[model samples]
Target: MEQQRSFGSHTTGTLYLVPTPIGNLGDMTIRAIEILKTVDLIAAEDTRHTQMLLNHFEIKTKTISFHEHNTQMRIPELLAKLANGETIAQVSDAGMPSISDPGKELVRAAIDAGVPVVPLPGANAATTALIASGLPPQPFLFYGFLPRKAGEKNRELEKLAHESATLLFYESPHRVGKTLAAMQTAFGDRQAALARELTKKFETFIRGSLSALQTYAAGDLKGEFVIMVEGAADKPAVDVTVPLKMQVEAIVATGAKPNAAIKLVAKQNGLAKQVVYDAYHELEK
Candidate 1:
């Protein structure tokens, strides 16, 4: 009875969210390796691909597939194991999982189901690109990747135009040309950088205006890309005497994103936002 009761208490497993190397296998961390070894099972986005990585490091831990395609079905089973005291670790094909990789849904599900999720920060392409970008890092948004369609891509870039943060994105070599062009159109003459093939022998970082990057990609597009674009230049105080609401309404009328449009128009008009606010208040009334 004592042995059975002791064994029965083995329940609820902790989940670990592991970050793998984006390029070089040698970048894998010792803690990550130890966690992977200790976990009861490893839920990998691509088992075969991770096998190569594990084989490189001589990590003999068990790996199972739990990618986007099968995650819907596998998540429930994973949760069941977790509830039964089986520790599971998740890994993506490369870089961090769920940032354009699998494992995000599982992480959320695990959280909702009361499973403990331990995040082991290691290698991430977004930060890698941002650091190499040489752009001011403050107030930057990591967009991951834009939609493939030209119209949607442009729309997304338009939304980011007035963000005033260094913008970051991941891009494939094949699509880098078109992405640069769309960025040029949406961002206009903004400063930008293209960090490509990061942490690899051919790692390259191209810093210039978005227009310049477009031309570079036209001739020398190779390797994956992480593009970082400087936000729109801040408005000088040439204008600022209006109430905020009027500015908001004025920009909303021009089909600009209400928030960005308002701020830009306020700066352009050289009026205090109070005046714009009064005008907008009247309009509301």
Candidate 2:
């Protein structure tokens, strides 16, 4: 009988980070199945959830809970298996692990211990929302979640409002309206996309300015939401590619005030305040 060998014996056991489907089961890959089935053990964010997945595929591989709450405690046990030449796999309830979910801690520990980590990428809400956003895409920042504190979230929003690229965030159903309102306050007048329930039957995407988004969600908004805020609107003669200082100089030359120039420059460049501020200051010297 061929003992199910996963990682190379010469090297420490490889950690397979598998990504599951967001909504549909058909999204699971053949390669991901092979890795999951063959591993010595599996670390799941939710054991009961993963048990259903395993039963569907008839994969009886052993699994243990490895989530944010228990991940720290379970690290040594998982590492010991890897140290003893047994491979391990980690999966979330949906999508990939370590993205606003648990498993990041284990990944960090594995790297620090010189264990090889292999990624089996598949579905991610951030990427899905960006593709369907219909906004000026690329060069976007992926904020896994806004800060829980209202003040912290606002400060972060204020910082990103100036960037020329799109701003993407993952928000839950309960806080969608609050997040939309916060963005409206910090970002102001910007066109945005509230893509909710991605890949699900009732998936809906709302496109408009921040105010429009708040109003749209004000009524019966349900399920998860992917908020995509468009970068600053196009401006006149303000090149977005140049260094912040040079760009600011060109705009300010056209009789634009420093504060207005700074604000507009950040928007035009789709850059943060610090990046734009340094450039504005350099141009003044």
Candidate 3:
């Protein structure tokens, strides 16, 4: 276990995790601006994107690229600079660094090297959208983004189907419809909210059932989306366990193809597809 006194004197320079505005420039904090101006160097996810922010605030601090592709190569260099007592500030293109971003590895390296990691809280799209989501806020899970692949995404949704906490997810407009449909299949006709262009002038939220949101997303896709799903309702404890083959049969009876039923059964039971396949074929025989 390591304890960090952010302002304490240390042999190495501190690594500051600074959060930037997601969309609206006014959301940028004064403290964040001061840190950017005073840090020895700014490690940015995209130098060009960060340049605009710097230009707006008139911050002359130099920035170096430290995105996903170059993280491995840049961590050591950034650590060496910190070791030499040069304060480093890390920022993503938007929002907080390392939240589904590229700063996590560097932060880990700095911690291991005994360097202080100071976090300056500011804007975050998930929380901003969550507060206005009309869902229970205390017990909410922030699931950044879903898998791009249909099968993998389906498996992931299956795992999260029984979660009691409200669920949050980031989704691109182009794929929101498909994702909503998948959620409908996995979680049933649950209430959900779709927030897009958060913190911006035209920010909008579409609140409805998963099926309705899926229909809405079928229109002209626009900006980034934050999907907030209502949690599963509490049910009295009961031993409602059914056989795997029986479950597959039930799904097949609902007009799903045999292979599709097998896949759904495997995902819901957290079993390998081959295992479900064998069991299903045996039952068929």
Candidate 4:
């Protein structure tokens, strides 16, 4: 357990996590601008991108690159600078730092080293879309980008199929159609909403069944999407009367490969893949 007073005076310099506007520059907060101007150094996901933001606000603070690839080289240097009482502000290309972005590691290292870390509340695409989505907002699970591989993505969706809370996901325009289709297959045609080009002039929201969203996504794929899916109703009990091996075989008869069938049956029956695989192959022994 660790205690931290964000504003308390400390021997080391504080790390301020500042959020930038996602689309509209006007969304940038006054305090965030002030922090960016005052910090001794700004750790940015992309210095070029951040330079534009700094130029917009006329902020002259120097920035250093701190992204996924260079975290190993940057974290130590940033920590050492903090230890020398040189304040630093970490910002992503847009929105809050560390939300499906870089900065988490630096924040963790700073906390472990007894450096004060302060966060400023600001725009977030997830909450921005959730409140506007015609779905229940109290209980929500913000699952950022899903796994890219089909098998891994499918397994992940299977795990969330029975969650009662509203599910949020981020997807690139090119893959939104495929993702919506997968969600429909895993969770059925539940009501859902898609927000894109948020805060920009073309900002739009499409609300309907998952199938409808999939159809819409097939057309002009544009900005990044925030997908809000309604939570599942109480899950129906799986039938245990049929032997697991037989269940896998039935799916295989539908033209699915043997391994694919095993995975599907396991997910549908809430069993592990290895367990289902063993049961399906036990008859061959």
List the candidates' TM-scores in order: 0.80, 0.79, 0.86, 0.85
Model 2 TM-score, all chains together: 0.79
Instruction: Please give, for residues 1-285, the per-residue lDDT of candidate 4 as tens digits.
Output: 899988867899999999999999999999999999999999999999999999999999999999999999989999999999999999999888999999899999999999999999998999999999999997999999999999899889978877899999999999899998888767767899999999999999999999888889889888989999999776445689999998878766644456766867787888889989999999453
Each candidate's number of clashing pairs is 24, 5, 0, 0
Candidate 3 per-residue C-alpha lDDT over 145-182 given as tens digits, one digit per residue, 9 for 90 to 100: 99999999988987787688999999998999999988
How would you encode candidate 1's per-residue C-alpha lDDT over 1-285 as one tens digit per residue?
A: 111221223446888889999898788999999988888999998899999888887888898899877978999999999998899999998888788898889988987877777788899988888876889988788898899998899888877776788988998999998988777655565789999888999898989987788888887578778989887777545434555565566555533444445445555776665555556556553
- Best by the TM-score measure: 3
Q: What local distance difference test score does each model get?
A: 0.79, 0.81, 0.89, 0.90
Pairs that clash in candidate 2: 163-270, 163-271, 164-269, 164-270, 164-271
The runs of at least 3 residues in candidate 2 whose Cα sits more than 4 Å from the true structure, single-residue gaps closed, are: 1-9, 233-285
Arranged by TM-score, best first: 3, 4, 1, 2
Each model's Cα RMSD: 7.2, 7.1, 3.9, 4.1
The clash number for model 2 is 5
Q: Which whole-number lDDT from 0 to 100 does residue 60 have in model 1?
A: 86
On a 0 to 1 TM-score scale, where does candidate 1 land against the true structure?
0.80
Predicted structure 4, TM vs. truth? 0.85
Evaluated against the true structure, the overall lDDT of model 3 is 0.89
Instruction: Report the poorest 10 consecutive residues by lDDT, candidate 3.
Output: 231-240
RMSD of 2: 7.1
